[model samples]
Target: MAKKSSVFICGNCTYQTSQWIGKCPECEEWNTFEEQLQGKTPTSNHLAIKQLEKERPKLLDEIDINQEIRTSTGINEFDRVLGGGLVKGSLILVGGEPGIGKSTLLTKVLGNLSQRDVENRVLYISGEESTSQIASRMRRLGIENNQNMFIYHEKDLENIFAEIKIIKPKFLVVDSIQTTLSPELQSAPGTISQVREVTFEIMNLSKNQGITSFIIGHITKEGAIAGPKILEHMVDTVIYFEGDQNGYYRLLRGIKNRFGDSNEVGIFEMTGAGLMEVSNPSEYFLDDHENEGHGRCTTCILEGTRPLFVEIQALVVENKFGNSRRTTQGFDNNRLSMLIAVIEKYFGISLSFFDVYVNVAGGMKLLSRESDLCIIAAVLSSYFNKSLDSRTVWIGEVGLTGEVRSTPRMDIRLRSIQQLSYKKIITSKKNLESKEILVNNLAVNNISELKNIFD
Candidate 1:
């Protein structure tokens, strides 16, 4: 006989407590705790222990290393984000907001794989959609169904596993993990416990059977993957499909990867046909150059192995109200405030009574700290009612003392900019001193030196 009791679990962080509380201690989220009936704990560790006992540990030198096996989904952008391609026996999780093209992208990948692989054994199990709905989408995506690609509409974890065993699929995709539930678990499908257990079972299956699995997940209102934080930790790779619903461009960012680089990103554009890969993201982000007027400047950022050139625009208006508003889009708000303060302190430009607004073009978020110089230049150009040279590019980190510091991968960044045929590159003097740099470079030691160049 086993004991059962009631427990309160936080949906955001999986913090379990005997009593319900207003706030979660781990995540500090309010009203996220849900009461659920706890079932008897399973003594399954004995089996795992016995299985581990049979395996022998080998020295690093003794183990033979083979070429990592990868299956390209035929979507170059998707494959690039998956670190060259999908690895054998890897469990991948994809999360995004509704209508962000998570399903469309994966469906296209499956379709491509079906066409490429002669013995395509890809099973797409959907818990939320009916077979008809999926078929309709496949038609819209121009995916002609193959004999090997199977679709099953089921939500029961056991039933899904049974189908997997029978189909013996080389690749599996669960439309979503939240909708799948086990019969034995008393909790609802999307509960923390249910999500955690369901994911663990699927993970075990993928590892043991050497089947690659892609699990779709929903994000909470907080923009994090729904369910417990532990769910993200258990997967081999975690990818977030992000884009502005109104915009056609989409970014697939890999936040975690056990086998490859974690910061890899793939760019895509939504079209009538399907999710199309944007091979030249630079052209997409910097398509417009006619509006090189005051408050606009160009900058380069490194996204994984690729360097991207994007325009930064700023607007500084005299504030009518007592409190001036500081707004930023695709740029950090705190970083903007810091830049404004640096300008006021060092350059003697008082932005206290001016409303400052900054935006990074193309709906792309600016994550690089090196974008500081470009931002400052844009702000100054807007404040002084002057425009920077259209052919100039800014690259440097701004410190508190208004000194321009060298950024990492300076050589790589400069090479990318030079390839674009930019007339002048502005950065710290150290960059110009490097003999490897082969570009027309402008050296600026501090904010004062930077202002003099434009003046």
Candidate 2:
């Protein structure tokens, strides 16, 4: 006999309570608690205990080290973000806003995989779309129907598992984890218990069968995965696909990875043909139109191992209202305010009544501290109504005392700038003295030195 009881679970963090509450104590999210029926099955517990009994602990030295095998998806940008290539038995969760090209990118990867080996079995299980609809998208992505690639439109977890057992696919893609349901659970498909159980089962399948799996997930209004936070923790890698709906570019960022470096980003352009990789992201992000302005400046930030040069644009205007507005896109608002205060304190610039707006070109977010100097330069240029040299690149972190600090991997940043044939590099004096690279370098120890550069 199974014992069943009603429980309240937080949708955001999967926090469980005996009764419903207005807000979740774990995640601090309001109105996220949902009532659900939880059942305890003794059979599952027995199975788990039996499974654990079959495994024995061994010494670390006793284990044999084998070379890691990685299969390329035939996309360089995608492979770079996946840490060289796709690792077998790895579970990957891909989350994004609707229509952000999560399905399209994976479809293209599957198409490429199908082309590589006609015998390799790849299974795509879609709970949201019909088989014909997926085929239509495959044709749009120029994927021809092949015997190796199979699509099964089903939402039942048992049926999906049955298909997987029959096919024994080397690779598996679940279009979405939310719509798949287990008959054993009384709650809806996207509930906390359902999602957690499904993910746990999928992980077990991947690890036991050595099948690489990619699970597509939907994001919430808060820009996080819609299901419980525990869903992200169970996967081997988590990737977020980001871009503006109206924009032509899309960015694939790796948020967590067990086999590769996290925070790796893959740049792509969404076109009629499909998602095309932007090889030279620096050249792609920096356009000539962005350079023909007073408030615009160039800066380089490393994305994973690749150095990308991006343009920072700032605008300063008189604030008719009492409270000056500070607006920014792809840049931190708090950092912008701090930089504005630094400019006012160090340079004695009266920008208290001016509204400041800063933007990082190409819809790319600037997370590195190295872009601090470039942001300051852009702000000052806009305030003074004087344009800085477009050929000059800024690379340094700004301190509270208005002193420039050296950033990490200064040598790599300098070499990248030099390769692009930039005329002058402005960085901390420490970086210039430490590196012997022969490039026209401008050493700036303090923020006040910037006042004389544009003059």
Candidate 3:
């Protein structure tokens, strides 16, 4: 028998060392190293290599192009984030904070897949919860009639694989990868070594067996998947649930996808039944009945291919004490500061002495630069205590010189605004020159012109 060796690994980046270090040189993270006992390496198999030698590499033209078959999870919003639908033999990793509806959403997905084909078998393996607990939750989700769905409560990797080999389910859901342990390793579950090994085995199983698999993962406090970075690289797609657990809305954002666009987003509302898709996210996000007041404005942004209208609100208050603070939610603080400088320089508004607060309604994070104009409008409205047209939408990016810049997909944004029956739009003059629009267009070349709109 070969003697076992011990090695230290970084939990964050999976950097390995013979000796434990206080800080990891690879990821620059401190105190993330954990020790693991490694077993003896297995001898190489000459027969397997001889079998591989029989296959020859082929040219790209030699490969046949066929339309990939996609199985819908019976959730439109989930399918949207998945680039249309789940592809066969694909390994998907879903990560989120605890109690953020990761299991609920995936449970619903299993139920949906089971209902699609009575002959097909779908399995749900849980490491954290009991089968009865999951069944009760499924009942609450109104998924009581899934005859083809099977649930197993097991954490041992060997037993799980044994069952997978016996059942040979078309779709598989692992409630979580952290709690699933490999008996071959001495490291505890959720450790870097165990996580990497478990994911590797599952990936091979999915690819070799043509099984569609979903693995639920826990996220760290820093809002990243709680495993080695290689865990994400090993999967076909990575999706994250974004929103406060207490909040009613959740946004599923695709981080990586090999088969489809990775920028796609899916919106869901947590309800008594389960996660219900929000068909019209624009209508759900915009508050139509609220009185138009200072510090509030509307803007349109594109998430993947979908256009959404979001409300931007700002509050400016005179700071009596220490330093003026700039606070924001769902908007970048550095960008807000730059926009404020532009407003003060071009509009001649002194906001340095005032504390500024900006927020995006409906808990939606604004990544698009097109919301810059709406944010500026909101801040100016709040500072001057004036209200702009409630039916108007602002869309444009602000340059350092205070020029309103054009944004991509302006036509799609305009059409969405018109669909919502918005009365007016304030954007760059360049965006208005080529097309005929139904609503009123308030085109401006510089931030100076925004003062006239506020007045």
lDDT of each: 0.86, 0.87, 0.88
What's the lDDT of the predicted structure labeled candidate 3?
Answer: 0.88
Estimate, for each residue in 304-392, the C-alpha lDDT of model 3 and write its tens digit: 88888888999999998858999999999999999999998998778878999999989999987999989999998999899877789
lDDT for 12 in candidate 1 is 74
TM-score versus the correct structure, for each prediction: 0.94, 0.94, 0.93
Q: TM-score for model 1?
A: 0.94
Q: In model 3, where do residues sit more than 4 Å from their true spots?
A: 1-5, 29-31, 41-62
- Cα displacement (Å) at residue 365, model 2: 1.1
True-vs-predicted CA distance for residue 20, candidate 2, Å = 1.5
Clashes of each: 0, 0, 0
Candidate 2 collision pairs: none
Candidate 1 residue 323 C-alpha distance from true site, Å: 2.0
Candidate 1 stretches with Cα past 4 Å from truth are: 1-4, 26-31, 42-62
lDDT of 2 by residue, 1-455 (tens): 85768999998777889998998898898999888987653245222122333557889999998888999999999998899899999999999999989999999998888878966789999999999999999999888858788999998877888888789889999989999876767788888888887888788778877889999999989899988888999999999999998999999999999999988899999999889999888877887843467799999898887788899999999998869999999999999999999999989878889999999989999877889999999988888788877878988999999999988877788888778778888889988875776668888889998778656
Q: What lDDT tens digits, residue by residue, belong to model 1 across residues 1-455? A: 76667899998788889999999998998988988888755344322122333557899999999989888888888887788898988999999999999988888888877778777788999999999999889989887757778899999987888788788888889989999987768888888888988888888788877889999999988899998889999999999998899999999999999988887889999999888999899889877765569999988888776788898999999997869999999999999999999989888878999999999989989887989999999999999889888778888889999999887777777777778788888888776674576667778889887656556
CA lDDT, candidate 1, residue 257: 91
